[model samples]
Target chain A: MEDVEAQTHLIGDSGEDPIISKIALAEVQRAIDSLPQEQREVLALVCGEDLTYREAAEVLNVPIGTVMSRLARARRRLVEMTAAA
Target chain B: MSELHLTDEILMAFADGELDQPVAAAVARVMAQDPAVARKIVEFQQSRRLTRSVFANNLAPDVPSELRAAISAKIEAYEAAVEGGEGKQAKETKSIWGGGMSPVRMALAASLAAVAVSAAYFIGQHSQSEVGRLAQLEHPRVLQELSRLESGRDAELPFGRLRVISTYRLPDNSLCREFRLQSTSTSTDAVACRTDGWRVTFALSDPAKGAEYVPSSGGDLLESYLDNLGAGNPLEGEAEAKALSETAR
Candidate 1:
């Protein structure tokens, strides 16, 4: 039940900000509420599982390099966003 | 670091532990020598951790057992149709999932299909390049073999080799097997029970110790799990064959 949302609807990519600022769940959830409906829908299917870059690309229907690039960009963005918080 | 000239993509992939053995090894050497490079890798790991933590926090209170059941039923139906042959395809595929479905239902259905595709992809990958490596129990041939393989003898398949060390019948009469999966880089000892499928109940990865039977190290863990299952004695010869034959049915 703890990860029911993570399990059922992987409907990310609706532009929702999956924030994890150190402040609190309330604030972090507020950020998630602000994200687009599809951001969360965009393939978070591979989370918690060990997927190769090629595997992740196939899951997302993106190129392998595109997978790496998004991973790079998303990780950096997460760092900056949390740092600023 | 400058000489290695590692790209962000490479670094990110390495941080994700997705790089192949050789490339990931190279990245590790560089990280060991350079603090800045190491920090960059750590940053990527931290970001991933944070994201997962947020997901853990926001999980819905109730398990979506209904959704899981629907998705599983759809998959079973699809597999049944595929196995039943080509003539009845349109009939079974349409009624189960293809009516006037809502947009949300459509997305859920699509995502569920994607998960199945991911499994197919694992098997597809195994068939082409994994004969010597025991990565996953995804191949049907492997499952079929598990159903009949006797203890002591092992089978070498294109996907990998599997050895059934022993078989057991629980107090409730369910059949279970203790087996090992061997590859070039590692070997895994596991226990799987007969159900709708061979469900893995326990697994432990061991360092690559060649294909030859390494005598038990005496500190085995799976032995105890079997002990708890009330497995009295391992079946052998006619008894073993009978147990396995019955399970395959």
Candidate 2:
């Protein structure tokens, strides 16, 4: 039971800053929160799987240019929000 | 260096590894040396990692037995409805899922319908001078095919062409469509649809995989094409039959 409980709550033994993790989590949430559904999806797919622009474009059924445009827009929003915070 | 105004999309794409090697390399050089852009990139990456961790556990959680049972029941009901022989009309009515449709299956049904309706007539219509005149008749056809495929299960429909290998509907109303292009490794397939056409979307392909799904924009734009045709409220009688007539060929 003790071993099982420890395993369940484990965040790994790395002593890295929880503060950075917290910041990252907050930033990601914020970036995605205000985004239109399509932008949020683009962020999720591009970021989540690390796909290339062409790949993302094909999967999303948009032109590569559109994919680039959306990513650019999404990134700008994140930067602005982070700056505001 | 001219201020290097990094757009959010470029920075995100860079962070997400979406840029091509040459372009990506160029961006990398800029990011490494450019303080403002680098800082922006890190923030987004951090967010991605955090959000993923937050919901990663949900991916593995056992779908509630009741929810699973409900889905199973829906599937059985759908099958029974199909077997009843209402044909294409019945399929569309049964498959036209709005709030009631499963998100995962909705995209498959919707995309299948979209692809079928949009592809058949529209493929030849483009680059033709008569494109504008044909648009009026084409829109209804897409909707009708969706209904027919959804309700009637037409033998001539292209739903059978594309193979839907897997599907999943998140607790949230996001429908995922995963398919392999018919008879071609060169083509890859995926689409995500929302409650209304307002939110219909697709995934990005794998860059290394090349143009896996080189989709021709069918007759209508895949995302916006379904705008008028919400689930359940399919075109009726002749309108529905006329729409599906092209696919029967």
Candidate 3:
């Protein structure tokens, strides 16, 4: 997560002031890291690698519906985390 | 459907590009009418971007030397097994490398495969002409050429060969055509539909993997996109001919 804080300085285009964007990005990274391992894995595979849900299911060895449910839960959790932040 | 009626699953699918066309369009229409739904969609997209950024920050600068050695040894073993007619061993080795590996390791391996494919295609091959044409997707001439091919024109351009792979009508009753462009160095698969003119909905390019490159019609991304759009089986033979004739008008 320290690496995330360091890298956030380079993330632009958020329309917020540069310092504010970096802080927001760092907070989001912390929120993601706090997720359960399974949720984090699903989120990483789909969002990070650009895999479709079916492809992510194949990789995670789960059913497609499971992938959808996990992803939905993971996303919902992130929204809640960010809103609280 | 009302914006208030939209479910989390549906909104997530739309953000992830999982919804079919009509459903996606309906979502879009609702978003236009509902600020809350639109804001949620934006939040979903931002979350995805943030998640990806975090992972991107974590990527190792280099592959571990031991992993490289393992890959090389595996390849050598695969070759030896092939020579010895031990097909089972080769299959076992592939499974061990592909299925048994960690997700990050698997992604690294996939990138290596893509690099190999790209290297094979780009070496000593002239790609400018083909790549240039593909980059001109919005040009009037390119659209005209696409339209001609969709309507059964079989003329070859200097860039390479072009042919329609499939044609389908969207829920809006608009006609779309999936086509392939094969050149010496690269191959592209694209979908364009007749709106005010031909508008490209999707396009993917790969280095020439063999003597010819034919993108699988059921490629994961394309399949997901088609599923979201509620696209049906591609028109073929007489159906394709009929769709082409209709588009001509």
Please provide, for model 2 over B69-174, each residue's C-alpha lDDT reduced to its tens digit, 9 standing for 90 to 100. 5434554554475578732223222211122321121111233322322222222223332243233222343333332343223222232233333333433433
Q: What's the ranking of the predictions by TM-score, best on top?
A: 3, 1, 2
RMSD of each: 19.0, 21.9, 12.7
After superposition, which runs of candidate 1 have C-alpha atoms over 4 Å from their true positions?
A1-43, A48-50, B1-3, B59-249
Model 1 chain B: which ten-residue window has the lowest total lDDT? B101-110
Per-candidate iRMS values, in order, are 14.1, 16.5, 12.1
Clashing pairs in 3: B19-B228, B20-B227, B20-B228, B20-B229, B21-B228, B21-B229, B21-B230
Per-model TM-score versus the true fold: 0.35, 0.33, 0.43
For residue B249, model 2's alpha carbon misses the true position, in angstroms, by 81
lDDT per residue for candidate 1 within B144-204, as digits (tens), equals: 8778788988999764588878988876687878888776755667667675677654444
Off-target runs (Cα >4 Å) in candidate 2 are A1-20, A23-27, A79-85, B1-8, B54-249
TM-score of chain A of 3: 0.75
Question: How much is B2 displaced in model 3, in angstroms?
Answer: 5.4
TM-score of 1: 0.35
Per-prediction DockQ, in order? Answer: 0.19, 0.10, 0.19
Worst 10 residues of 2 chain A by lDDT: A1-10
Instruction: Tell how far residue B41 is off in model 3, in angstroms.
Output: 8.5
Q: Give the residue spans of candidate 3 off by over 4 A.
A: A1-85, B1-101, B104-134, B150-154, B207-218
